[model samples]
Target: MTGPDRTPPPGDPARDGDAGAAGRFADFGPPRRVDGGLKARSTRGAIGVSWWSRRFLEVLESFALGTRLTRGRSYARKGQVLRLDVTPGRVEATVQGSRAEPYRVGIELPVFPAALWERVERDLAAQAFFSARLLAGDLPAELEEVFADAGAPLFPSGVAELTQRCSCPDFAVPCKHLAATFYLLAEAFDADPFQLLHWRGRGRAELLDRLRALRAGATDPAGATDPAGTPEPSGPDTGAPDAAFAGPTPDVEPVPAAGAARVLAGLPAIPLDEAVDRFWLPPVPLPDRPPTLATGPELLLRQLGAPAPAIGGPGLLERLRRAYRSFGRS
Candidate 1:
């Protein structure tokens, strides 16, 4: 929704350039407009587009490079303004320019197939704004015919004659105003690719719905003729019968009433040696050894490899005292 092609002829006055009249594009009903058009949110579109896109804004500022924007020129830096209008088969984007000629450009958008939307999002606009994404990159591969139909190159150079000209006298270089408008448009795309889509008059939700319709139509080719034909699929019979009336079966057999069960006490006992050998044994205490500072409290202090006082438990301090006491005595 940026502007017309470089060689864009003046649009037909009899028509509103395919997007309809100015009033149609500016229709801001309840819940859609906010702060008087500073912000307009579509009720259906998730517009999940990150509330902010750094790269999109960067591209916008990219257009601002070498312009008065770098020098802080106020009027020259004013950005582009955009809006959208949607219909079943068409989307309209109103692209305003800071420079002359067609002060505004109206772009008509046809129902884009689902297959191309992602490519449009990723490689084109980086998915910043749906409408902006539509116009961001060179025309998508799927729509090569459209560009050819319009007699425009897929990629218009910054200085390409195919690029639409401005009424403003500023020549070769896009007038500062045009740059500002483009810069702002890029920012709008950065903010939300939906904006571009919106300008094109096609929001994310609408695009998805159209795609879904197309999918349904494709899947129901036979039904397409009937339109309302509800074809009952001749699939394998997978339906189950009502479960409440299933047949009953014979009961399980019961064991004899007086059957005996073995008791633990009645079992044969093991011999003492066998029992003793098989029983779990506590870990055996190691032979006592003299205390070594390395082992700390775990060290077994002794006269010479004897168990330390109760394994350094009760009277632990007394045991240490005695160890030192023997040092001087003998």
Candidate 2:
């Protein structure tokens, strides 16, 4: 096979044919019937959790029974043929070239959805979940029951409950064909924990529920009000000064006791824009404009008993004259 120079990585699945497995499962026997005596499936344990995909292994680890999935020496690397069958389940192929006889074989890996993993997300302000329980092999008891009830199963000490089968003619002592399938399924498990669960008819939904609870517990309690509360306007004394600036505006009239005409008598007919501009803009030094401040020399002198002209600054008129002089110069 020099076409592409393909060597099946130990435990790598060959989708189309068992020839790729190269006699890996030849010693393994045929797949057992679903209703076969418990001893059939009971005869074989699952590959180790570490042998499967990091993802599915993670979910398994999260379960209370994670360790139950690993069978023997974990066979960290074994060759296998994993394939989707023409019908329902997946198939495994093992080619035995050396032994009592040489033959090509295939077996189905179970892909079911026994327990649904619940959806979960970390509350940023709360816990970092993926690194916690899921990775630590601490699954809860509640979800374990759901998976057990399903015909699909989990290896008591391992991560995934995989199918064991092979096309070998030998008695079912884990002939190479089944071994290849087991190894292949283990490799597949390492690729994605969900794939094994899917075969076992399980999913992440249950894990998600646990995650929800985990995260919920870790989250900081919300304010006395909303956990994520919208801020509210507080008491008048405790609010912003502008927020407290209420009641009749200084600019608004008091309504003048109904019929009493509002006397615009002494007030100047000042434009609104000019008033707002004066209130908002930086003070302007105008050559001809009258003083904006109403308090004057006489009033200041009479109110404060000060000397006539001014204290520290130039006289108002002199300042006005100097401004006019500058304007003329410009």
Candidate 3:
């Protein structure tokens, strides 16, 4: 069983105690390293590469863990962490410390309830851009805002939101060993941002499936809901025939059925040989000029935003705009 929350308040020197002192001392010495350890890819400077991972590390730093975090960073660099596993609501790891036996470490964050996730998934599915980016394995920076708007912050906002534990004899909430694990966790998140979602109680497959279902439902409301409970619409064939013609068409005149049939029967039947020369040509004369545009040619380019860097840089849009203007003038 886990012990009571002995985590001292932020900036409390008592929290560090003897463990804090040892952490500082360990900066000068090295802990027992492990073979085939999961070392951080970033050897120098910052640990996390992606923005999401950096945001996690930033949250950890804000906890005021002081020298212990520094020692953990050192431990991470030395590859002292033996193994790490991230699951829904928890991160478990084994770290090689000064002792012969490895220290067990765990960090827990509250998982969003199913109802909250439903809301989050709905919001995400509502936007095609967000769904497309996620499917392409790219986590947009704006996703954090999405979660925040849903009342479920994607990253832990404060230290209190995290429950940290280490089997090491450190009274400090996160001994150097735990700190090292945290750093590595950030790196892991950098590699696959879906790991962060997994830690928050939603696996990538499950989330993606739900997103797809929600999007499908949005497009077809008559379909049945998926297992995830997203509403899906039935086929268009189920709708009434009149529903297809529900919209108004003020300019169109409805042809009488008898008149239409007579018109079709009255058409002249020409021999294939006689019509061969004009088979591909229009029966009527073409317009004297092309149709005029209601908007400028550059309007499309403006709506599409900027082209990719490989296609054109910042000035490309301006040059294209000028070229489009010349087309109209000519």
* Candidate maximizing lDDT: 3
The TM-score values for the models, in the order shown, are: 0.30, 0.28, 0.61
lDDT of 3 at 45: 79
Residue pairs in collision within model 3: 220-233, 221-233, 222-233, 222-234, 223-232, 223-233, 223-234
Root mean square deviation (Cα) for candidate 3? 18.4
Give lDDT tens digits, candidate 2, residues 1-330.
001213333455441235544443423332322221111112244433442333333333333221112321122222223232222255434343233343344434454432322211222112242325444553322223234333323443332333344433434334434434444455555445545544543344544555556555444232234457763434434543442234333432232110111122234666777688576653333222211222222322222222346553346545555666676567
The candidates, ranked best first by TM-score, are 3, 1, 2
lDDT of 1: 0.34
lDDT minimum window of 10 residues, candidate 3: 254-263
> lDDT, candidate 2, residue 265?
28
* lDDT scores of the candidates, listed in order: 0.34, 0.36, 0.73
- Residue 94 in candidate 3, Cα distance off native in Å: 0.2
Over 4 Å off, model 3 = 1-29, 221-330
Candidate 1 lDDT over 96-130, as tens digits, reads 33222223322232444445443333222212222
